[model samples]
Target: MIDNNFKNEKAPRNLGLYIHIPFCRTKCLYCDFCSFVSRDEQQREAYVGALLREIEARGTKDYSVDTVYFGGGTPSLLSAEQIGRILGEIKESFNVSPDAEITLECNPMTVSDGDKYFKELRALGVNRLSLGVQSAVDGELKLIGRRHSFEDAKATFLAARGAGFENISVDLMLGIPSQTLDSLRASANQVIKLAADHISIYSLQLEEGTPLYRMRERYSLADDDTAADMYELVVKMMKDAGYRHYEISNFARGGRESKHNCKYWRLDEYLGLGLAAHSDFGGKRLENTRDMERYLGGEWLEAASDISNSEREFEFLMLGFRTADGISKSEFLARFGVGFDEKYGEKMEKFKKMGYFCEKGDALALTESGFEVSNAILTEILDFDY
Candidate 1:
């Protein structure tokens, strides 16, 4: 039965692809990304072969993919042959545009192997490299269980440049147990020195099972006040370095925003392939099993759900609030076939009255303070069933 509920809504699809590589050299303390700590080449080769098979088995990709991301266990850990094979699979499976922004997640230690890694990655058509250089200080790196040193990260950047990578993004974290303002700045400064095109400045999140979370039982981390200070410091430093804070945790130089992640922020559809991967396509949300065993045998899809109209609306408001440029008013109206002012008039009016939302032409954008308590503000706008 077709529901009339969202008959007024606009549905847009500019598709993207996410390929997951669930293998890692070591797991970090505050990390929870799906990756296994193993050097089993046999397992890796087998996984690559299976992934190729999966790619081959996929339904026809009718849309031209503008962005394709190879996220990790440590994609850099893969042999050149392995990386090439996967890219070949991608080429064979879908119509990836020639100028597509193909991004690969790499580790500092991985590229220390030199031209072999970078040359192969470039040859395979990856244009962007997101390097995980969590911290520059050795102490902070140790505390966070990161394998690369400040020096190693520099070496990795040098290697990438030597290998002819022009578009590179560096990942750094804030609010670690031993992290300080000076330490954090040093990390950022070193990364900026590399002249990376983009940077992902993430806060240290203590998940339930991670080592950092367990450390909470023994040592005190930076307090909320200090963490906030660290985040603000990062914002300032990155901005001063000529990077735009396009998204909360991301910054890019010039036009170097991450196309892959922007797809997520824009609420566009994507299909993820690998253990513990998630996919949102055709109004359906699906997640693959986190189990490697299940992935090997083809019993991998763990869950699927068609999102409710209410849920989609909630997502729209929540995600729109995350970007520097808040949701487009005309686009919002077009999507819902009604004035955004009509749907969330109370909240919009309330916020504008309170000076939280500023009228920006046809869009309603969050003021600095509005962005501060964005969750509370968005909650007021959404008609959540829960």
Candidate 2:
């Protein structure tokens, strides 16, 4: 059952919608997400049907959706008709803003044609495209088990441009097996020249069950210091290339920041649909079960955990610090009934003196170096329990 608490709330309709597609052509060696390699047409169709039904069952026309993100194993794996129908359902079921930022995450190999699939997706209301171009080197891509080569990624990017996608984001990986500082810099430079509207720089994690983790000694991965240097170099490169480092791992040109992802950093309410998705609504956190059978059978959400004011305060500070704009002191005071400075002023003074923090007007944000050690900084703050 849909939670009544979210429905009863008097807040303005600023909901975001996220649709997860859990099908991929091939699972990457390092991927641990809820995705699988499947060519079962029936299963794909069935999954879409279940997703549409869930949208109808949970969505309200009264809620004004500002953004809709179709993210997944590979959203572009579906036919153009399938994408259009899913988008059509979302529009019919909700008060989606006419100018809503709709994004689709795709793999380079999936949209290489660009003339057909990507163009159709654009016409279907997908204004932004996030292409998974993990590296610029073919060898690194092979090490990471990506299906597409660097040439394929370049071709896909050019195709997206030809297909009329002005807002394009490319993903880049920092640490990979057999990756060196020179190779990392070369990739970063090449991507910068691509002039993608946005870039998401991520580090490779050695998840326990991943193939890379299992055969860890086969490749020479960059050490922690080298990885940190790689990140710093990338940050400098992006900035010099006229992109703003708006978040810890995200850089955008002009005002091309990701609307859907910004909702996550701001703790705004968003509804998640599909297998293994998560939702934050009714003042609680809810995660849908990962079981495909359960999701398709109409058992959608798992359970809800109500958020406390204390938890909210902590998140506000932590998430806000991740952004370039930082936290708003006035907003904090308004939300929590206490001045932010009064609560954590003394604690932050030490860091401020160390040049880790910058205070301009009413906003307090971390410096670039501070972003490097954000976890440690956040942990220390949480430990103090202000």
Candidate 3:
């Protein structure tokens, strides 16, 4: 169905594929993602089958897939065989590049037999692993409803390495319940000791309707000021440890950034293939149905809207600012036929003078202080009617 809409494409483009697995063992207290806690193997198999069918129906040989990501409610929850089947279908349906960066998000607790499990995944062409090690503090982990302990995460990381995985990422969280500066430092130090290729540190956001939000009064969550202090400390620590703060929430060794994620920031075309997954492709924005029954019944599309030029411009600036590299002035002009300064220079000069913005060579990026209050700055600067 999607193929018919984009059949007149003129040239081949590189694509990133995102496959969502919306099943988890237990939902975290702060999670708002589209995931269900289900142990029904039949349901999992049925979901996989639907994904395979969608891949066949929408996939085109017109694009070369350079990155494939398995994200979700713990993608590693699926057995290696199931993951392999999905990857096999994708390869058969699309022109997947030989050196495509394949990444899978894993929960440490789900890796029952890490050695065998990770080895099988490696053999299936999955080259990167993103372990959900939310905190190295066992108490904090418990308070956050994480099933895996710090030890479990460490063991899983070691096992992934034993399975020949070189590109591994560990996730850490700030502003968890009962998180103090010392506890935050300990968590950061412990994850750093693992020497993972990438580390993603996120500030926990309390979403409405989540368990954490309802119990907000019960926990000693870090205040705004404390959270900002924690961020500053971690940035310095990561830089000292030779990791680049490549994005607002991501740190990585040189040349180890997540290729699939960069596609989103760069506004490159990517196709999402699962329930509640979203795709920005064929000059349109598409979202798959969130209802499980609708998804399993082969009614995939929930919404399809054309992305207007102005919307694209806003997104290019918004997403680009999330990265340390920011936006390229030349590329902006080349793509939109308008000079970046001609459009935004007047409004941004105040912030630049105040040390919130920086221009290095061709890149216009936000300073560290700018990232601190990026929301306020973006609100004021991205106010143009065009």
Candidate 4:
């Protein structure tokens, strides 16, 4: 039996639901997502129970959720019945819109079950699948410790299509230890050939705690010069394939951007449930503890994801500037109730002179070169005496 929780509510928000599935088959060397290697039936069932109760507890808010995202250790690991039940819970709890974009992140290794599980997931309301297909080259995939092969990824993509997922996204990685520009290009070209609806290309981030980080002490990663060249190749290839480089790392065909992710990039409020999930209910950012004992037994006060307005402003700038569309002055004003130009005028004056910032109507967007130096640009925005 699950205990009912007192829901926290705030002013109307650009609300979204982020359900974390914290289990994986084998943790990738580069993986740092909050996941544990487990296949315990009891634990899986327990998590679903807690998640359902939490969903029920938050049912009081009369807000619209434009998206629901299942991210994690590999959300595809869960049985379709578990996922379906939670969707039922969400529908029973909140005023979820009929046309909301619901997404599930899946790893290629799991889709070969031949059980027609994805169809069941679609029946339960998951309309999009973000497939983890980091590389097509066997050496790079082996270096990164992915469980699935390139062949498996292709089969999974076909399976997802067979299962009725029209809006599919593939995750691609560059700068792996065993990768060269040509090798990585082969992966990107393969993804394009698959005709995936969306592509998210991420430069490998070597975090200190992962196995890949330890291996990095010995392995020479593809050089920064090479990585830049790889990115350039990807831009050309993906554009030729008819995908729009909407954000720094994301590309989509037509208008198939990840609506759930937009909620995050646009600094909209979201509720994150499950161990190590993060949330920003209006301006107060929170993160659930990574420890299962603390998260499950104690009052789940996830670490703070957002705090003061100063932090919020800096974060907003950091997130908003990552997109080619950039942050809109009007949207910023609508959220903060202050004109962006009024707040960031002199600051923009400098960046404008630097060929980084440009004006489109009342909005400020970044140029292609500006994206390469976006972090430093964020520093310039943050240095403002706000």
Candidate 5:
């Protein structure tokens, strides 16, 4: 049941919409996301139908959507019409902002007919494109089970440009099989030459049960120290190229940061739809079922939990520290009714002495080196026994 307070509130809250398209042409060796390669058109159509039904069932006028993100096993794998229908349903269900930042994640291999595909998406209101390029070296790409070559990625990017996309982001990986400093530099330089609006570089994590993890011994991966060096090098390169390091793993040109993703780090409200999607709204955390059969049959929710005040406080600090701006002292007090210094002053002083933490104006943030070992630092600092 919808909350009466939410429906009767004078001002509607800003919300973000995340639609998961769990379909892929081919799964990457290192991938563990909920996705599969399905050639059955009927099954895909059925999934889309289920999504439309869910949107209607959950639709509410109490929230205004400012961002819409289409993420998945290559969301571009869906037909343009299917993508349009999903967006259309969202608009019908919610008061989507006129200038909402709508983003879609695409794989180069899936958008081979890039010109037509991207043009259709552009016409359907997708203003941002996130291409999964991973690496620019063909050998590195092949080793990671990516089907497209670097050239193919470049062409896809250009095609999106030609189709009138001004905001495009590319994904890059740091530590991969046989990745060296020189090769990593080359890849970074190549991506920079593309002049993309945004870039997200992440270290490769070999998840358990993935092909790369199962055959981990077959490939040569970088050591922790070498991977750290590569990270520092990329940071310098991005700084020299005039990209702002807004978040731990993201860089953007002036005024081109990902608005949708920022909502997550800021702990803003958002609604996630589709198979295995997760949402945090109205002081509640919810996740959709990972089972495709259940999702297709309209079983949307897998689990739901009410967030405690302490958990919210810890999450605010944890997620806020992931960004370069860090957390605001006044804002923390306003939200939790307690001064941050009163709670974490001792820990902050210790970290400051170690040169790992600093206070800029009214906000407290971690240094670049601090971000490298943030997991340990945050674990120690936010270990409240409440």
Candidate 6:
């Protein structure tokens, strides 16, 4: 069952740059990401200036950047000129590859005049757009405190197309309050019809302190079992619609997978810039201070943690399991100086017998059922000490 093609080694020395824009029109009820209400034009301009200074001070020209992602509170909240200025700084400060995949995440409400925004973004070298289209059902969206209507989402997608964004991704939400299997399927179908190159279907999570968590007692949301059913149905439907399930929550058309995100799952190095952004580069994990005022004052405070070999191996296995590609046995041995089966052969046999895993070539991947309980399996199987 061994495959000779899969080798264990770090990929070529390249960089993936992630720029966080912590400004948005409004914070969604479920968002826990570091983004605040849209600031005044003066405040916004000052923030962009600070970001540019940070990029210049910290960005290195040594590594060739192959991917750049502008993620947000709502990156689209920034005018195209502002976004373009940041891109210019990155390009000047780093050895950005010519064909780099530059993506910007946008909320539908911010893109009512998408044609104008999209064209400017394209001119700024951003080739991909990731639209936040949480739900196709209007009622569900309103309950979630989303500002855009379903029709608005459709219009924004069309606008992106008309403005020349051939590589676009759409986000969908499942298991939200009052979200049924039918509604989830309808949303998935709508996105599929949009022919977005990539699709990300995330299950609504009830994190404490969010508005949804406070309102949980009032709304009867889908139970775990119902959510599981919705997950299965969407998986089958997305496959039928010709999208490959590349990652747990992400799907893409052929060759359209997110290159920047793949680096994260593969345990490759990436650098994140901006307030509260995290980075794993040069063998340490670093997190920027979340305080915007402190950041603006030129105090780029950060927390740094060095990763040991054991921690790296643990991450390699855990992250790889989240993708269609299961970890390679030979690669594990090469990297860790221990064979996969030699260390965990019995555990592998046990899970295989339990039908949670399937052996293909040198890789042992989770069955569809296994993905539902991956946390439990990983906890039991991976020895953090080793």
How displaced is residue 105 in candidate 2, in Å?
A: 0.3
- Least well predicted 10-residue stretch by lDDT in candidate 1: 4-13
Q: State residue 291's C-alpha deviation in candidate 2, in Å.
A: 0.6
Cα deviation at 245, candidate 2, in Å, is 0.5
Q: How many backbone clashes does candidate 5 have?
A: 0
**Model 5 lDDT per residue over 168-193, tens place:** 99999999999999999999999999
TM-score of 4: 0.91
- Estimated TM-score per prediction? 0.92, 0.95, 0.95, 0.91, 0.95, 0.94
Candidate 1 has an lDDT of 0.80
Clashes per model (N, Cα, C within 3 A):
2, 0, 0, 6, 0, 0
Tens-digit lDDT track of model 6 for 138-245: 999998889899899989989999999999999999988888888898989898998989999898988888888888899888887898898899889988999988
Better of 4 and 5 by lDDT: 5
Which segments of candidate 1 are over 4 A away from where they belong?
1-13, 353-355, 383-386
> Candidate 3's error at 21, in angstroms?
0.2
Error of 1 at 292 (Å): 0.9
Clashing pairs in 4: 285-305, 285-306, 286-305, 287-302, 287-303, 288-302
Q: What are the lDDT figures for the candidates, one per model?
A: 0.80, 0.88, 0.91, 0.82, 0.90, 0.86
List model 4 lDDT by residue over 116-213, tens digit each. 88888888889999999999987788888897899989998898898799999999998888688888878998999999999999889999899989
lDDT of each residue in 89-176, candidate 1, tens digit only: 8778887778989888888786557776798788888899998888888898888888878899888888887888999999888887
Q: Number of the top candidate by lDDT?
A: 3
Worst 10-residue lDDT window for candidate 4 reads 1-10
Q: How would you encode candidate 3's per-residue C-alpha lDDT over 238-271 as one tens digit per residue?
A: 9899998888889999689999999999888999
Distance from true position, residue 340, model 1, in Å? 1.8
Residue 113 lDDT (model 1): 72
Displacement of residue 235 (Cα, Å) in model 5 is: 0.9
Q: Which stretches of candidate 2 lie over 4 Å from their true place?
A: 1-12, 384-386
lDDT of 6: 0.86
Q: What lDDT score is found at residue 261 in candidate 3?
A: 92
